[model samples]
Target: MRALSPPVGLPMLAESDLVRQVARRLSDAIVQGRLAPGAKVAEAAVARELGISRAPVREAARLLESQGLLRACPRRGFFVRALSAADVDELYDLRLCVERHAAVAASRRLTAEARAALRRQLGLMRELAHRDDPARIVEADYQFHRLICETAGNSRLLRLFDGLASELRLVIGLIGRLYDDPHEIARTHEPVLEAIEAGRPERIVAHVDHHIGVAWREVARLARTLSPTPGGAA
Candidate 1:
């Protein structure tokens, strides 16, 4: 199977590491739309809800702020940052560059075991899609793409792709209901897998670029629709 880059220099932080645990939970809430775009995030409220002190919660907010998932206002509390259409376009463009390289490289170097693992991820995605759980489906979709990066055998490429995971989750959360069939989501990925399995680098690159391009357009459309007009209600 394709190997993930072993996390480097990460000191052991057990589950009891309250700050990180709190941060992860908050991040999940944001990525799953439990916290909506522009919704105020109060440190005290979150701390009260989670049965913790405010310090860790405040630290967690700062962590998310660094990731562009939260924004701090001067007088008000932190809020979920609204990703604009331009933001979506930039994210997709960067993703396209990284994934195209990974797909093309994986086509040339993918092993049989890695192919099997990739197929397994795709199967999991199909199952998640059928269950109609957007959060799980989005995660599965990310895992499948991550496997492709792993198959590329480039540690730097995998690291770059991993960096985008949080923002990608934000995009998926924004889109909400991805497709009517949901199965269509799983099925659409097949051609990419097929191309990679065929060991055709050009085919893999073309398919990846096209796939991401379509997703970019859809997100951009949704962003424009949701964006407030000059005189419109936000």
Candidate 2:
């Protein structure tokens, strides 16, 4: 079994909270590529590394499974879920549809507060871009788009976007860097926000399409090379 990094000491908390912490550690490993795609999650090894019982590790794996980040085989236990280029393309297609409509709706219902929030998020993305952490950068990027969906005030749209979060994060993590410079990734959203501020539905949709479309093309191309782990194992 591969040794996994232990998270910070577990705080005194309820059983559910402990499970959540374990799940977070595992999820971080997946996002950071410490745990490669299709790698089996040795529950006992993880428990030993964290100095905890195996029960919580098992439960956490189940939680990750629900999030589409891990898969549980009949007798092979849990392994990181593997995604292919086609999967990446399809996921982005759904994302584009949801975001295009959400951006259009947000433009119609744009509020001062939401506008400020989006700008702050953009600033955070710019700041994080200069750093070496891809996960934080990707998170900031996701939040900016998420803000648009929230501003749209459509619960279903937001739910759909949230549903795609884990898989999208994994795909971006695999691609490593979407643009030549991380700042370029942040800059792509500038036009999207500008179009929204202009309060033009067609313009907002066009910018959203272009922003997401470019990422889709790049990620799909990269995913073709990485592909999925054969037989769902490394």
Candidate 3:
């Protein structure tokens, strides 16, 4: 995937809170291949480049390390994790399984407020997603699915899903690469949300299954082109 430049019109914050901001910037760089797999990350140089102290850079690397997006080697420094087709498939499949059940359960408890909120998400996603920018499309896609999981109303599952977001992103980003049609994605979403709001559990499940299967196929199709082997890289 190409480098995901910070979105236009993003709010600017100061450097006082450097750790998380540093981590986020570096994480975006890794995800977008500004920092490619196995590329060495130097804490001092990163700090120098960003005009900050090394403490935050080290902290950022440690954060990424915990997320499995970075690793340290003997006598070497941090490096981006290698992208893998198998890893993406397994993560996406697991997400599909969790979300399908959540959708069905959420349908049984649908409320007016939840329906309105979901409808808002679908609309916002449709608006931003139509742009040619993959980053915006992918960001909207995340909000859309996360909205579903929230409507599902399982606190534990929501936390679990949040924890797995980075892995979730691998396939979601791949989906944007696979298909250029945002209207298609947005159009298909209405029926799915409609079924959920109508309290049709069976239809909700089928809708969930359909969406996941379609998204999965797109990810699988592009992941193959990513080349499974990083070959001596991270």
Query: Evaluated with TM-score, which candidate comes out highest?
Result: 2
In order, the Cα lDDT scores of the candidates are 0.81, 0.84, 0.73
Q: What would the per-residue lDDT of candidate 3 be over residues 1-234, giving only the tens digit for each residue?
A: 898987544233343357788988887776655775567788998999999889889888888888877777667777776656676677777887888877887787678887788888888777776555566666677777787788788988888788888756645665655555766667777878887877777788888888888877766666556542233154
What are the per-model C-alpha RMSD values against the true structure?
7.3, 7.3, 8.9
On residues 1-234, what C-alpha lDDT tens digit does candidate 1 reach at each position?
A: 998986554343442377789878887787786876778888999999999889878888888888778888777767877778888988998999999999989887888899999999899978887788777877788888999999999999999998988888788666555577777778878999999998877888888877888788888887776653222212
Q: Where does model 3 exceed 4 Å of error? A: 1-16, 36-45, 130-133, 228-234
Error of 1 at 12 (Å): 11
Per-residue alpha-carbon lDDT of candidate 2 for residues 1-234, written as tens digits (9 for 90 to 100): 999976555453576798999998898788877887778899989999999999999999999989889988888789888776778778998988899999999988899999999999999989988885677877787788899999999999899999998887777676455566878778889999999999988888888888888888887787666545554532
Q: Clashing residue pairs, candidate 3?
A: none
Clashing residue pairs in candidate 2, if any? none
lDDT of 1: 0.81
Cα distance off (Å), candidate 3, residue 64 = 1.6
lDDT of 1 at 42: 85
Candidate 3 weakest lDDT stretch, 10 residues: 225-234
Specify the highest-lDDT model's number: 2
